[model samples]
Target: MRLRDYLRINVWLLPIILILLPITLIIFGSSYLSTPNTYFNTQLNDGWSVSHGDNHYENVNLKNFNLGNTSKGDVVTITSTIPDMTAPAAAIMFRSILSTVTVWIDDEQVYEYGKDFADKNLMLPKHYNFISIPESAIGKTITITFDVTENNAFSGISPVYYGNLFELERSYLQSKRLDLFIGIFLCLFGFMLLTLSSYLYMYHGQDLSLIFSSVISFNLGAYILCYNDLFNFIGDNDFYFCIMEYVTLYSIPFSIIVFLVSTHPELNTNLAKVFLSINILFPALTLILQLTNLVHINYFVTALHIMALLEAAILLPRLVMNIYRRYQSRKNSPDYTGMTSDSILIIGLVVFIFCCVIDIAKYNFFNEFGGGGVAYTGITFMNLGALGFVMSLFVFYFYHGIEHINAAYVKEHLEGLAYTDPLTGLMNRAKCMQYMATVKGNYALISIDMDNLKPVNDTLGHLEGDRMIRCFSDILKQAFDGASLIGRTGGDEFLVAIENPESGICEKMIEKLETLMAVFNDADKKIRLSASCGFAYSNEPKLTDANSVFIMADTRMYRIKEQHHEDKLSKFLDDIISGKISQKGGEEGT
Candidate 1:
């Protein structure tokens, strides 16, 4: 009904709208945009023949072509007729994995790769083979030979493309634009998370979950870029990028485990620790073996898949159980709120694991049944799943951060209320005693007592007395602006403690107090402001601690107060005797 209430109720919708509006517009606008079509290139998916050691297949479908079984050093030869091409610069393009390739256009050699790697006993990395076709080669039979370099590596062949070289490359990159955007976005997001988490850890002592999340995000992003061969834009070193791909991939599970454990310590079970240890060891061992030429990292794909499945088997159930228990325990409580960050995290984890299962299943399924190809031209479900998981982690991190900040704010506010005097905002008596009881080092304690407080209360009311006390407290604050401590110790009683006071500093503060009081009294005629103050340094003889110094200061302050009283009485009597002032109702002049 009210504007404030409406705003309060709908404030959360603002971010949702801001996020969804752009997405909706993009979805809507995309329908009107022209669809991408091949202008200068064509996919050659049919009319291919394959020959492998005593076996020959005719009219094989190149799009889903595969050799049922293959061994290291096995050779598979494929031949296809190049269609008519009008483009001046022509080429045949396809991707190869873990294989050395040689291309011949009607017996004239046109392209070769991985011969050096094979000679050196190194793994051949996956690469896009773009063989330039001579203008005279049109209508000629194009023969390609794949020398499989690893067991189980020759799963299937990528669909061949023939046309203008640059256009084919452009189309290829254009198809990968979404994946590129996501990969780069994720890397940048991870860097931003690292920066923010580092600051929070240094200043606020936050946990390492944010750091782990950042690592996971960066690794996943790198893995995406490398696995898709998009990182070739940055560098043409396919071998190093292949290593990076596996390294980043193997590193992810460890960071994920660490992040989960950091966020939910309850998840740090023995099984999780074992998984963490294996995740740590697997990558290092694999990398060492690869570098030593004992075994290539590509051969460990099945092992990594098994490890992931095992981890998910142990973690997913426990995570779901943990979320269930937490929700059940808190559901009926008055403070209950639906869907905690942990719940969101579990959901994200489930979705991520699901996507991984799909990818893994697809890989195995196609290898067994659908001609052994696992490449998707556009963004994969794994990428979308990873993005969702990372977003969930961001939500979890920020939710807890905001919760911590709110808790700290409430604690500080409560502490302020407990220690501070409501009227003058000075330290209360309890806080003063607490400070004095534990105070260390050399210091001077000044005891201050306001004069004529009771008389002001009797004549002008307690409100005026309170005003006088506040005025005196302000004077004390101004006099000892940066003093160690100032407090209202009792009614009309105040104390100022200065640590390591300079020579004559105590006297100077007392003089300043008197001057401020004089100025305050001159400005206001309602009540004369006066206070007797005496300070004793801790270095004074026989002053063992703050309490002793305080006692000495109080004693000296009483002596000053007695002198003021005596002087006031004498002045009043002098005035009365000289007929300058008169007593009212036989009362003594104050």
Candidate 2:
């Protein structure tokens, strides 16, 4: 409920948001109001030209333009020259015909396509030639040859040449260095924000679902802008933006649903079910559209991203408000409360929504208003949501964890009242069976019976016998403190189990019982009570279950009590017979 509680979780998440959110704004949100004037500057690197007169056998379609074959005579001439030759960067070009496509610079075979070139380099694709010429190849005249070999595919057409994209050059030299450096700077800074955010989620024990989703968003951006040339790192703009496009595609919807589910725990189950089903369906549909190229799923995703952000904006506040109200009522009442957790969660959700909306507005609306200056809000706000998410999850998990511990305590305490004997405070017969059902391992079960307990009840009254029962149960508790379980199975009966069967413990315990009997009567007016105990230890796992152990102990105890009773009866009969014989003899002699 208080601000200190919010900070506990917020402390970790803030730095990440401060770093990443701003980057999100600068990279994507920067052009929101207007495109920057700097975007007008385009540095051309791999620019080449071919006149209509330059080709001998040319096809209107550029596909496979470099290679063609004719049975008798096939020829195509290419006039090659490198721009910025003094700059010392090799300009690469390639041509292919039939089985062979040779690459040349400075009039020599720098790379051969579809040949032993595979052995020389592992990076080379087996089916295509992606050649590179060193900067040393510049300032020299170059001749290229694409000799037709076997001509199995196209034996009768002459070779032709076509244009390629501008990529073969990179400049360390700064004709326009400041502008380039600035763009790179923004990107690096943005990347740091993104990385910081990810670390917060992974390290702070936050929910990984949205963390992973946001990570995918960041990855999408890097994939589009900063990958290597093997995938045409600077391919046609259409293909090059695919990664960014897909990033928006999946992450937009994913982020929305993750926010909804994590932040709203009390939604109706039916509504949640429907929403979750649709969530799965939407992603799958989008993936299908992408893989098949059935339609440009990017368009839907981008449009949906804006919509989803708005929905999150609306839903997040409502949920937070509800959590706050509930927390206020429950804070100190102890019914069930998690004010700090709810507050952190609400704050994170609200700030994240606001940040996202601002980002969207900055990109689509503000960027269009003018060049990049008026439009793009630079990244710096990421810390808000980053910190919020961390705190929210911390609170969320903590709330649940504490609730679980309390529940366990309540259940155990309540169960003791229900199943335990009131007088002895041991488990009753019902509890004995329950314990037998519940417990396992090697144990010693002791079944005790007071010798001639009914006669004491008859002579001294039931109250005195009851006191004896209570005393004996207390003795059982003392004998097996932490070593075993002592429970009142029924009237004058106790059941106990000890782990790993220390049978010597039984002897010491029985001796203590005898000592209690000797001292117990004088203080209580000459009422003597002795108990016989039978116990057995089973080492076998299968035989060590409670029921089997109890039966064995009970059987052993009965045998000891029966033998003592027989000895006492025999002595009493002998005394009576001797007394009667002496009396008859004395009477006859008189």
Candidate 3:
């Protein structure tokens, strides 16, 4: 119906179309990309033998193979025959966690990892091992040795795969494509939020909630990408990514706590302060210990987990109670709109906490009961929770922003009403006084008074008098268009102030006012309109302030009014003496 309505509808529709287009294409294209290349890849799971100290196991299925009663420094050896394959080049791929791996094909060493780190008592980074298989050794017996570097580091060997390297990599990445997309999206989104928050903080002086949100999103995204070995596909720097994984993991809780405390000040209790301090100090201490080789960063995972759970347990209930109280207080109020944001935040926090608890419980369950190892698939319930939480925060931020804008607009409107004159649409006396008190520098103050206003009101009615006043005010506004202030100080009095006026500017403005009055009087012959105006410059001798200049101008204006009365009286006498008016009419006007 309207152009603005059309534009608004398009604005809403365009983003949806843009978002769905790529998704539709990806959905259709994924079938082709996700088709498995079974001929080039094979999982080598069966017919493996394992040997430990004074023990041997045969026909071991490598999938979740239990390394019963293992300790640090205990060595386990696995042997299997390489499957026959006609590929030009092939490799064996498996993931190693906190262990040193050595592979040999018929007594010739092929690939080794973590040996140096293990020897130096340094923490070993987890990564996938892709050992190239010689074409001649396709049917050769392969001996794989795993030296355990930590207690219960892994209770089972991961399923190994024999495949073309590129094909194996492709398959692994295909399985994790969703994780990749979400992880990258979160990282980029976090970066954009971080940049936006920084600008608002530095320039606009906004609060820090968005900054904390950005940190939470970016760190969680990075942890997901690294923990699942998905980062290996992007950058194969195992040690750096491993460090990033731990650092980003530790940073998430810190950012989350700060965000909660900043957004809801009631949550910033003494206990919260202590947790905040610990979050800051503990991560730095662990990093120092890891760098100095005294202890590995991984050693504190359980402690970190416990601390996170404890922090949530202590703070979540307090937050819930606070939000509940606020909701109850405003339940019946007409302006109650904040509950939506509060509910979103609460839902997000609950989902995030639930996911965290699930992940922690699953980790402990698998490690203690199911096996000694946990599989990280890059995309977990925790990722979903993080996304949910961040989205909720974004919604809250936008809603809060809208509320702030609305408040500012209402405040500005009220201020305009307070300072404006209703009748003539000019600044009222209060605003004029305010400007006069603050005005500075070389300026001119023009005081204006309408002539014969009382006589006009008495002869014609008050309405005609009001119209005359309004007409004169319009003329003053036009004449003083470049002035700093044009105000109706009283019913028949007005003022114009100009700052740093050029030479002869006041004279030019006065002449312009006279010319406009002449034009108005010629057009509207109901009343002969006239006004007396006098201006005083701030730079003149003995003029110290705007008020002083205004007083001087008012004094001059009264003197001009007296002179106009004298001239009108003298003209009337001349008309009578020249017999231009009859003797009886002249006596009646007198």
Query: For model 1, where is the 10-residue window of minimal lDDT?
Result: 25-34
Model 2 worst lDDT run, 10 consecutive residues: 38-47
lDDT of each: 0.82, 0.51, 0.81
Give me the runs in candidate 1 sitting further than 4 Å from their true place.
Answer: 1-11, 14-39, 203-206, 316-347, 376-379, 437-444, 455-464, 474-484, 498-509, 519-527, 536-556, 569-590
lDDT of 1 at 200: 78
lDDT of 3 by residue, 1-590 (tens): 43233334555653675478457546743656596775568888789988987789898876656565357888889999999885546889988878899999999998999989888897778879999887889899999998888776766677688888888888888877766766777798899999999999999876988899899889878987887778877786888888888988888889999999998998888988999999988888889998998888877888989999998888898899998997797655433443346777888889988998888887776555554246432236787677667777786786566546655665666777998887788889999999999999888998988887898899998999988888888888898998999999998899899989999998899999999989988899788789888889999999888889999999999998899989999999998898878867778899
- Quote each prediction's TM-score: 0.85, 0.48, 0.83
Q: How many backbone clashes does candidate 3 have?
A: 0
Give a tens-digit lDDT track for model 2, residues 1-590.
43334445556665685578557645543335332321112222222222222354322222223222232123323334443333222234332323345555655666655444224221112122334445565445434444333212232212222222223222211211222333344345445545765786778667544454344334333432322112233354333344444544454445445545654656434655565565556666765775565543433544566557655655555666677777777666433433355565566556755665665565444323423222122222332343344445445556555654554665776788888788878877777787678876566767777775688789988887787788777766776666556777767777776777664877777787777677766566646667778877766355646678777889989898888888878887886787965676688999
Q: Local error of candidate 3 at 47, Å?
A: 4.1
True-vs-predicted CA distance for residue 241, candidate 2, Å: 11
Candidate order by lDDT, highest to lowest?
1, 3, 2
Question: Which candidate leads in TM-score?
Answer: 1
Tens digit of per-residue lDDT, candidate 1, span 1-590 = 43234434665964795498448545543434334545567888888898987889999887666676577978989998989765768888888888899999888888899999999999988888888877788899999999988888856777788888878877776666656766887899999999988997999787788889999899989888997889875688989999999999888888898898988889998888888899999999999999999999988888888989988898878878987897798666433434456776887788888988888888777776675355432237788788878877877765555445544665677889999999888999998999999998888999999998899999999998899888888888899998988999889899999998899998998999889888988999999998898889999999898889999999999999999999999998898897666545345645
The TM-score of candidate 3 is: 0.83
TM-score, cand. 1 vs. native:
0.85
lDDT of 1 at 577: 91
